[model samples]
Target: MIYKFCPAVLLLILSFSPGNLFFSETKNVKEIAKVIKTSSETNEEAIYNSLNSNQFALPQLESFKEALKGFYILKEKGLISKNILTLIDFSMSSNSKRLWVIDLTTNTILYNSLVAHGRNTGNEFATSFSNSPQSFKSSLGFYATGEIYSGKHGNSLKLDGLEKGINSNARERAVVIHGAEYVSNSFIQNNKRLGRSLGCPALPLELTDKIIQTIKDKSCLFIYFPSDSYKGASKLIS
Candidate 1:
């Protein structure tokens, strides 16, 4: 009787042992698959490029790429209705001070003119300031400072997180596209240096109005820089 009972007890203990317990292997497999799918969806080329590049080096190139990515994404998302006209590749020179208008739809270089930018002396970061004056002398960079006219000018295109401040307010800064005499090829030939603006992108006075009109309203205008921070922030270029 004792022997029979001992054998029965041993069999019962083995059945409940940790080694004999069956884990849900299928559940673990499903979880891993879900993680992979999520990673693939969010991993775009923009993210990879930004991560690999040096942040402080080659700011202009990075900025241009980002601007491109931004426009491309906007088109993809149906935010922009028209085709890109051009990608002006300027910003190569510390004293370059020019804007290149490219025909995005045709890949043609429409115009390359001398332009003026912010004084490299005051601030390396050409910031948009409120309380700044409006005249050419007062214009820090052709932008109006303050909250008085936050959403009143032009159509409010969403810059998303790219630019600071509101669209309406941006107009008050008077950052409209314009031209300048100093930005002409003649000026470059004579002076051997591109002109500088307070902060507004002043183009050749000859082409300023036309370029403004062409890119006014709903068109996209990208100002490129080579900062690593900009590259990481934009989605247009990889």
Candidate 2:
């Protein structure tokens, strides 16, 4: 007679039989996990102070800090390389300059400019989001910036979403950072809001080059929205 082991039991046996096979980071994982757990609480006042000092809008600081927690966890997991962080506040109205690129290492804001959401997201605000291709809706979560390419939108930067089930399909959707004529004050004046993209984070034509160069190649980008689904399901956040 042969004794058969259950899958769960086998997994438990393998976990104990490993030299750091079950968890790669080992001791560092605990430190990182602690940071993530206290992120919202420990970071609130300090992040708000920094945002105020930097002249970043106080209303957006909460979302910024929330996004930073995920970024920190991703960094600790060896997901992103550069200390450059990009943020998109989809909760803001379409006309607001809601995109920010910051150097986390130097604590400097590199760019804060108007970026368009998907055409179908909303008229002046983005509420609906998706990870499906052709949904033409912006997906919320952490992303890693990829290589640059010159396409029909001129110079553009590719983005790879890091989170599963939320924004993992970003690359397949062709959702990229590209320049657009409509992401300007003139367009906003004409239409009462900035022109939206095909789910791409469309930037101003003039600044795409500089922004792309700074954040390209494995940098982190976090598209934030106050959705309950994302907040509950995201693995990078506590």
Candidate 3:
């Protein structure tokens, strides 16, 4: 009886041992850290650092953060189906390659090309945006890539604006992505700025097919501008 009692006591002591407690606490700590790392803002900063270190021409970190934030939210909501993210930095001058097509899954830059804003937006920089039909001014915010259609622009990709009152009228405005002779380097050298689109985010005629194919079909497209009003009011990114 005394031997059997000793074995039970030993088992109870081991169950309450510091080593057991240490293992349980360590596991809990790891789980907590995993949750924090998964949702922390530092994750965005880390991704930006990774992209920047890769030598790809990336958008400003602030803009990239906002773009990434919105991208995640949109993806969670099932608005964006693809892992590709297209960012058009309207804050940058038209002469620069402000359009960045990124592969989020692979963490690589697919295309860094010149994308033209609406003619009424600005000459060198896009300062104005509108969602009104025929406004011909580019609308700022998030957009979902729509079906590819052979319209007047030829093999154009339609864009479904996601932000209401900011760019929801994109389809009605016919603000699609298409090839444009004016969106090339030659046009920029002659005009001192890239040619403007009616309201479309026009791409170089040469890259139009490739970009349209890659970004089409429910990818995330974010037209970023450092506007206080848009930032404050945007329901998606705000």
What digit string (tens of lDDT, one per residue) describes model 1 on residues 1-238? 1222233344544445354344744554465456544443343233324432222222244444455556656565655545443233344552443355544565444565555555541222333322233433212111111111123322222221224321223344555445566666676677666665644556666665555545543445566544454345434443
Clashing pairs in 2: none
For candidate 3, write residues 114-212 as lDDT tens digits.
999998999998999999988889999999999999988899999999998999999889999999999998998898889998989999999999999
Q: CA lDDT of each candidate?
A: 0.43, 0.82, 0.86
Candidate 2 worst ten-residue window by lDDT: 1-10
- Stretches off by above 4 angstroms in model 1 are 1-64, 77-79, 85-90, 94-98, 120-162, 165-169, 189-191, 232-238
Compare candidates 1 and 2 on TM-score and give the better one.
Answer: 2
For each candidate in turn, the TM-score is 0.50, 0.80, 0.83
- Model 1, position 164, has a per-residue lDDT of 38
lDDT of 3 at 147: 95
Name the lDDT value of residue 159 in candidate 3: 91
- Which candidate ranks first by lDDT, i.e. highest? 3
